[model samples]
Target: MSAEEKKTRQMPKGGRKGGTIFPRIALQDAVGYARRLVSKTHTSRQPRDVIYSGVVGAKAGIGDVRISALKQYGFLDGDAKSGYTADELAKKIVAAPPEELPHLYGQAVLKPTVFKRLFDTFQSDTVTRAKLKQRAADLKVHPDETDTCVELYVASLATAGLVSVDGDRITHLASADMSETAAISVVTDENNQSLSNNSTVNSPATRIDAGSDTEAAASDIGEEDKNGFPVPPGNSAQPAPRANFNVNVTLDSSMDIEKLQKQLELLKRFGAI
Candidate 1:
């Protein structure tokens, strides 16, 4: 291949064009935009009006970079001309259950900047700014812009509640506490194995006669007796024990009856009579 072609091919995805890569903003900014967008009092307005309304906790004048971040991360919708509104995702964020919020937040944050790459690079409790810079470098970002990417990532994560900031230290948060919802069902098998998403546990004794049991097939739940059911190895009700035995018999035509009698006597001796 030509050297020029090879060089172009080697360029990192979303690599820097001028001094830095594509614009990025803090996580808090996106969260603020989301909060305002879903509030009952919120109305559709130009991006500038929303930013300056002081709902998102922006102390300084809102800039294009901040507005751009909201659009890129899917919090805001529309262009500079026709005005902006809350995107569908923002609505979901407001309505999503508390347990589901973390995953939703993760999806929102990973949409922009070096945050996604830096998030993947994190293998432990904390990720350093130096490490984030290295990730930016890998993305072919300019040395001057690496710090910008790192700062954006750190602030964004802190806003997302995925990490805690202590001066320079960035510590990742434990996974959000998730609980089962109406959309999801968890079940345990006879062996105490857990399954989710309406999964079923196969019963060893209950044979599912599919073609014959059409009515049973209509329901998702397993058929159970009104009282109770035995799992396996029979129920606790005491019953007489039974044994299976195999016996070999030999007969001769000449002395069949006498030989049969002798064999029967031997069977009695062996407790098989």
Candidate 2:
């Protein structure tokens, strides 16, 4: 391949880079796929077509995002050409009792360097969806996928019960064993500051809940944050003309239709003016 052609070649999704590309699907999604495999194939490697036919979604197809997620979580093994089978961790999860799932899933989640880093960095600190996005920006995540990355990461965290969301205030919960680390107690002070591992952290100032998921996620991660997903520049003609305006709105957890309508109306009024 010529130098220019090599530069044009796409980067491999995960195995090669740590956190450059996060899991497209959530933990529960990967769990669901593995659960189906346990019921149908019992950990045996089966042909790609067979697995695809047996475990199909409402969309009539299982996507690469899901397959990649399963692999990242150490839930699935083998390749499309070599066939696919549920890995040992997957077998254990399927066999474990109800209460053990969160613990097991927590371990699987941290396998990805990105998730692991986030968990390590934010496990002790108060985290908002916006805060996570900011951290992602710090990690050089692409602007276009800022919301998507946070959404999927939040989904995984929610599934593992790692963080509890309440009206934009996220209280980090003690999850599975990180092996090298010892267990600790969770205590909340009068001000809702989390005290854990003998350390104290005041509640975050931005108590914005993670309920709306993507509302505050469109934060800028810089123009160069093209982590394999690039956000192309808009055409010159597409820029707003008359109502040249920049507005910052704080959308609360009460994202009811009425509230949404009001915000929409406000923006529409600007356009009309």
Candidate 3:
């Protein structure tokens, strides 16, 4: 045989000598395989090599293949070092903004619970109870039930688009407009009640009558006390007039007038007016 023919015959079918051998798989392909395994199992505790071999075998319909490609490519750590927990990894994946996620975990569907964890991380830092109580007092509202009051305030923040709920965390998303809206609502409600109370106090029906002799004597004593003068014997100063303006405003403005009137009627019927 010619030397060229002899050399050609000695070469393997696909270019190598002896038995046919394939080139090592690319790192990207190995990573893809590993990712697929993790996603399928939904657990990270499995033996990394076993999972990789199973995935590759399942896909290629071949005999046991070496997972050395995964190790060489840095897809598998292969050491006993403690890495971040699955929950922590899931949290990181979820917290990643929609635009930035494609660069991190590649293309994969994230579960809702994972997203919730991300949200919780964002919302973990929130307004404290003391701060909320101070805010309530500043707004002239009695925060009798501090716990419920804070919860209601947080709900209000959510409704006003100033905050969002990410799992158990209360994430603040307040903009200048949102703050202004909340502040304006609180101030307006307080001012409206103050004006209503003033109107009620100045109403003619609430004026004290001084026509009777007993009423005149009481007024005389009250005037003496107001003028910083001493009162004579057997003459007691009148008690200061206490005007109680119990103003209850309806929170639901979306309700029709007829519905509101019916609610008022119901309250009156129940002697709650």
- lDDT (10s digit) by residue, model 1, range 1-273: 888988777655773266544446676667766777667225665554555454444534445566677766778777657766777778878887675566567668777655665666663468667866887888777777888777877776666666677877788654332123212312322223343432544543333643356664444223343433211223437532333597876656777796577667645543564
Please give the CA lDDT of all the candidate structures.
Answer: 0.61, 0.67, 0.44
Instruction: Give the per-residue lDDT of model 2 (tens digit) for 121-169.
Output: 7874677889888878777677677788877777788787777777776
Candidate 1 — which pairs collide?
27-156
Please, what is the TM-score per model?
0.47, 0.54, 0.20
Model 1 residue 78 distance off true place after TM-score fit, in angstroms = 1.2
lDDT score, candidate 3, position 51? 52
Off by over 4 Å in 2: 1-19, 56-62, 174-273
lDDT of candidate 2 at residue 16, scale 0 to 100: 31
Give the CA lDDT, 0 to 100, for residue 203 in model 1.
47
| 157: Cα error in model 2, Å | 1.3
What are the per-residue Cα lDDT tens digits for candidate 3 across 1-273?
789988777644552222211113432354455555445445554453445355556423231232433333234333323421123333344455543433333212111222222223334356455655555444434445434444544543353344566555566642344445556656866887897878866666556542577986775444333434434334447543333446486667687987677666644433456
Global lDDT of model 1: 0.61
